[model samples]
Target: MKCIIGLGNPGKKYDRTRHNVGFMVIDELIQRHQWKLDKSKFKADYTIVQTENEKLMLVKPQTFMNLSGDAVRPLMDYYHIHLENILIIFDDLDLPIGKIRLRQKGGHGGHNGIRSIIEHVGSKDFKRVRIGIGRPDSSLSIIDYVLQTFPKRDTEEVMNSVNKAADACEAWVHKPFPEVMNEYNQ
Candidate 1:
C-alpha cells in the first residue's frame, strides 16, 4: 500500500488560503475518483482507492501543518510503506504561482510541514508534489502571505494548477517518479 498525504491547516477559514492548496488538490482527487475520505484514524482523515497494482490511501493530516509527521509515521509503520512509496503534496512559495514541481527527493526548502515530516520519518527520500503558491512581492510577512486568500483574478490559474497536480499524481501511481517529474515539473 502507498500513502499520499496532503498537507494543510484544517478549518473553513483556511479553505481558500494558499497553504491549503494541498488539501484542495486531494479533495479534487477524491471527488474525481468517487473515493470517500471519511475515515478518521492515524491522526488523519483518509480514504483508500485502488488501481491495478496499488492500493492508495489518500490522507489529509488533521494534526495540522506543523505536526504532520505525527500522523505520517504511524501510518507508515502500520501499513509497511517505505519512504519511497510515500508521496506528499504541499504548497511551495519559492516557485511561481500556479506552477507544479514533482521531485523524487529533496530537502524541505524551509517548509515547516515538510521539515516536521523529515524529522519524524528520519529521511527525505520521499516523493513530493510541490504546488507553487509564489512568494509575495509586497513586504508582508511570509506567514501572513501564505495564510491569506488568493485574489479573484488568480482563481482560474490556481484551479488549473490543481487539476494538473491531480493528473500528475494519477500518473505518478502508474509510472516512475522521474517520468512524472519530467512531464509535470517544467
Candidate 2:
C-alpha cells in the first residue's frame, strides 16, 4: 500500500489560499479518479483507491498545517505503511509559482507542516511533491502571504500546476520515484 498526504489547514476559511495548494492538488486527483474522500479518521479526511497494482490511501490532514503530523503518524502506523511508501504534497515558497519539484528525501526547508511530519514520522526518507508558491515581496510577511489567495493573474497558472502535480502522483503509483521525478520535474 502507498499513502499520499496533502498538507493544509482545514476549514473553508483556508480554501484557495497559497498555503492550501497541497489540498488543491489532492482535490484534483480525487476528481480525476472519481474517488470520494468522504471518510474521516486519523485526524484526516481520507479514502482508499485501488490502482491496477496497488492501493493508495489519499489523506488530507485536518490537524491544520503546523501540526500535520498529529494526523500522519497514526495513519502510517495503523496502515502498516513504511516511510518509503509515503508521499507528501505541499506548497513551497522557495520556488517560483506554478513550478513543481519532486524529491525522494529532504529536510523541511522551514515549512512548519513538513517539520511536524518529520518530527512525528521520525524520518525524512519519504518522497515529496513540492508545488511552488514563490516567496512574497520582502515587505509582506510570510504568514500573511501564504494565507492569501493567489493573484487573479496567477490563478490559471497555479491551477495548471495542481493538475500536473496530480498527474505526477498517478505516475508515481506505477513507476519509481526517480522515474516520476524525471517525467514531472521537467
Candidate 3:
C-alpha cells in the first residue's frame, strides 16, 4: 500500500492560502478519481482506492502543519508503509509560481512541516511533490505572504500547477520514482 500525505493546516480559515497548496492538490486528486475522503482515520481524513495492483491512501493530516508528523508516523507504522512508499505533497516558497518539483530524498529546505516529518520518520529518504507558490516580494513578510490568497491574475497558474502536481502524484503511485521525476521536474 502507498500513502500520500498532503501537508497543511486544517480549518476554513487556512483554505485557499498559499500554504494550503498541498490540500488543494489532494482535493483535486480525490475529485479526479471520484474517491471519497470522508473517513476519519489515522488522525487524518483519508480515502482508499484500489487500482489494479496498487492500494493507495489519500490523506490530509488533521494535525495541521507543524505537528503533521504526529499523524504521519503513526499512520505509516499502522499501514506498514516504508519511506519509499510514502509521498508528501506540499507548497514550496523557493520555486516560482506554476512550477513543480519531484524529488526522491532531500533535507527539508527549511519547511517546518517537512522538518517535523524527517524528525519523526528518522530519515530524509522519502518521496515528495513540491508545488511552487513562490516567495513574497522583498517588502512583504513571509507569514503574511503564505497566509495570503493568490491574486486573480495568478488563478490560472495556481490551478494549472495543482492539476499537474496531482497528475505527477498519480504517476508516482503507479510508475517508478525516476519516471515521475523525469516527467515532473522540469
Candidate 4:
C-alpha cells in the first residue's frame, strides 16, 4: 500500500505556521476526499483510503517535528508499506516561498523531521514533496521564522502552494508519481 506522511508539529499553536505547510496540504487532501484522520497509533493520526484502484494511508505524525521517525517507522512496519510506495511531505527552507520540489530520493538537507525519518527508516530512498517555506531574514532566527504564521502578503501564495501540493498528491492516487512530478514541478 502507498503512504503519504505529512510532517509537522501537531496542535493549535502549529497550525498555519510556515513549518506546517505539510499539514496544510494533507488537510486539503483530507477535505477533498471527505476523510477524517480517524485512527491514532504509532504516535500519529492517520486514515486509510481504499478505492477500486488504490489503497493508501494519510498520516500526520504527532511525535512533533524532530522525532518524526518515532511515528513513521512504526506505521510503515505495521502496514508493510514499501519505501518506494511512500511519499513524505514537508517544508523546505531552501526554495523560495510558494514553490515546491518533488524528488524520488534525497538527504535531509538539515530538516530535523526528514532526518528523523531517514534515521528511523534506514534509507534515503523514498519519494518526497517539499513545500517551500523560504529562508528567514537575517534578523529572524530560523526557529522564530518557522513557527510564525505566514505574513499577510504571503498568505495567498502559501495557500496556493498547499493546494497545488494537494492536487499533486491526489493525482498520485491514480497516476504514477513521476507523471505527477512532471505535471506539478514545472
Best by lDDT: 2
lDDT (10s digit) by residue, model 2, range 50-160: 899999999999998999999999998998999999999999999899999999999999999999999998988889999999998779999999999999999988998
CA lDDT of every candidate? 0.90, 0.94, 0.90, 0.92
Candidate 1 lDDT tens digits, 120-155: 999999999999899999989999999999999889
Instruction: Tell me the tens digit of each residue's lDDT in model 3 across 103-172.
Output: 9999999898899999999999999999899998779998889888999988899999999999988887
Model 4 spans with C-alpha error above 4 angstroms: none
How well is each residue in 1-186 modelled by candidate 4, as lDDT tens digits? 789988899999999998899888889989988999999998999999895688989999998899999999999899899898899999999989999989989999999999999999999999999999999878999999999999999999998999988888888889888899999999
lDDT value for candidate 2? 0.94
The total number of steric clashes, by the backbone 3 Å criterion, in model 3 comes to 0
Better of 1 and 2 by lDDT: 2
Where model 2 places Cα greater than 4 Å from the true spot, the runs are none
Among all windows of ten consecutive residues in candidate 3, which has the lowest summed lDDT?
Answer: 38-47
